[model samples]
Target: CSTFLHKLQRKSNRKRSVVSSGELHRNRRYAINPLGHKWDHHNLTYRIVAFPNTLNRDDTRKALSIAFTKWSDVSPLTFTEVTANATADITIGFYTFNHTDCWWSPLHPCFDGLNGELAHAFLPPRGEIHFDNHEFWILGKSRFSWAQGVWLNDLVQVAAHEIGHALGLWHSRDPQSLMHPNATYTGQRNVGQDDVWGIRRLYAADKKRVCDPWASTSASANDEILHEKNCPLRCDLPLESELPPRHVPRWLKWSLRCGHKNLRTTQNRYKTSPRASRAEGL
Candidate 1:
């Protein structure tokens, strides 16, 4: 999810109008749509597996489920545990040893830092996860805060971050985001807006075109058609690239001309559209 942002930003905007020119007759391509439908209507269950050592089984399980539910709220996806020996689209597991250096972090910024890399998860199609066994996997106060910490790093914070990875989110560089490489206590209570937006974008693609027979697997096919074929207008558009991000909301716009880095500001920025500029007093 975090890595996707860097990739998605490179693509140019798509045109949605109906055109008859053969050069403009774009082929259908598969891209994740931000505003697309979710998988909740379908009878799909994402199985989450856990390997607990120090963390209580019940509380850890509860926390993992809660993390998935956060994405479920924005997505129409439903998940359930598979009790039997069955394979699933997404599988969850934990690690106690540091055989793979994925959990080791010389770059980690946590207060205790090195002892706990907190948590890590593999992207979809390769589901693997590991948590630091050295940390107190229980819910208790940390050395930093005096508050009763019901959600420790190994449990709540790590679970949330791993779940983000499992959902196809890449780590975000933004400090306030849940997908950031470092974990924070504030991120545990809720998924950050950016995390939600990223998950919604990733799975939304899976919902609409993951295996859709009508769409191209590579999204670049849209620019190469030499023959004039009557294609669905909606299909030709960048499925995931066109819509504004979930965090953008309906009322707000990204004003590059505003010269304000903050998204929330009272003064509207300059605009190309005179009417909109006038409406906002830009």
Candidate 2:
């Protein structure tokens, strides 16, 4: 992952372009590359050298394909998945502890095992995404027990965040964005306006195509697609235990006591609430 301080210098020298007010607002909500490092070409290829046992091989492939499509749909970039033998711009895999040049290695930052730090990726040109195999990874929707240190980290969500790093995006302050440092279990399968603007800022959208930066795609549609592909496990529903104690509002505490039958049901209600969707940061 790109270091926060090293790449955050303000880009005051580059000429600014006029964008839609909405897009402009979204762009301003996040951090961008100071040096503006980005892929020189539009077509990029990626190869999956390894797969996690958390999801079946086909599910893993489908999850990554959708993650790539999220970015490709709104940007000029196009991603082609190639075999391991073929040369590719990006390489992805799962690892634990000191796997090669990952965080624990002497060359890179140290990775905290299991729950603390989930994954990291290099910036553009490097194009390497590594997931911590120590953590439990989940595909779509499935029952998970957080108390057992078995909380399922959404693979597609993490893939999307790591891909942002690969595509030259730093972590965004906007928590709703796919580029946020932490993952949310709200079943956000589509890119947010903040992510769209950030990627577009790095590489302008293709001239032949027009994209809406703020359009919301149906998460249910994506879930249906995954189910149709035979990847039945869906973990999109919110887990009450997953919500940090700091985030639980006093009003929500009262609601939890009176409005809902159980913690799971309360969380499901909270997940759909507009306030929860807008809650910022990790």
Candidate 3:
């Protein structure tokens, strides 16, 4: 029993260390890493296979739809929802514990239960986003008022972040960017300029007409169109002074650590091995 307890303590400490390292890496610079691949085509379809019990079907759909819109509005790519089809370029769903990353499963890096990690996504062609169903997901603005015990992760904000991953973006060091691994819960929904620039780097924008009346007389229509389309939305990167200060609530960190303790206790009862413990219905 002492050996078992020691092992569990080591594992818990390791997990906490990883969390700390990830937090540090997420606040460094603009681009931390890249998926190294992107979709060949611009148009993409997504399907929501499962919904969380925390939010109704309509609310879940709305939150996800808004997330998709947030990306499409800034980028040249387009996303269409496929309700009838089970397969799509992107598959979004909610799973608890080790449902997606079981020993026998092909996928990996599963949810770490209620807290610790909220959600994750596969990059580019894989296009899979999985949310920890155990989370207290705040779907709409009004829903947060009724939230009680658990930390309420904003659905739209998380969705937008995950969607950025699905589109081939890596974790950004900018805390204000949507692609930041540890995105804050500030109730702001729009994707940051850094995120927009990242996606643009992956997929070139399709040709679109622009109205520019003040261009030099020598500049042809095609030249004006090229310049206007290349610099979509004015490319105003957020200055360091203008960026909001990183704000993580003290209670959130405490809640996650407490949740990890419960998870550790549950794992110990089943078995020390993650696969064996998961198989035994943890």
TM-score between candidate 2 and the true structure:
0.62
- Give TM per candidate: 0.48, 0.62, 0.60
Q: For each candidate, what is the lDDT?
A: 0.44, 0.61, 0.58
Candidate 1: segments with Cα more than 4 A from true spot: 1-50, 98-114, 139-154, 185-188, 205-282
Clashes of 2: 8
lDDT tens per residue, model 3, 13-119: 33221112112222223342333678888789999998897888888889999989998877767898997555699999999887765444333455667676677
Residue-level lDDT of model 1, residues 14-101, one tens digit each, is 4333323223452222122233323333334555465656667777677767766765554435567665377765566554554345
RMSD of 3: 21.9
CA displacement after TM-score superposition, residue 133 of candidate 3 (Å): 0.6
lDDT of 2 by residue, 1-282 (tens): 424332443344134443443122213554566667889997899999888867788988898998898888666578999987999999998887768654444324555676766677777788888887787787764336868757777788778878888888876666687766554545555788778767866774312121222222334424333322221011112222345545765443211111111323353244322234335221
Please identify which of the two predictions, 1 or 2, would achieve the higher lDDT against the true structure.
2
Ranked by TM-score, the better of candidates 2 and 3 is 2
- Candidate 2 wrongly placed segments (more than 4 Å): 1-27, 103-108, 141-143, 146-149, 185-187, 206-282
How would the candidate models be sorted by lDDT, starting from the highest?
A: 2, 3, 1
Clashes of 3: 0
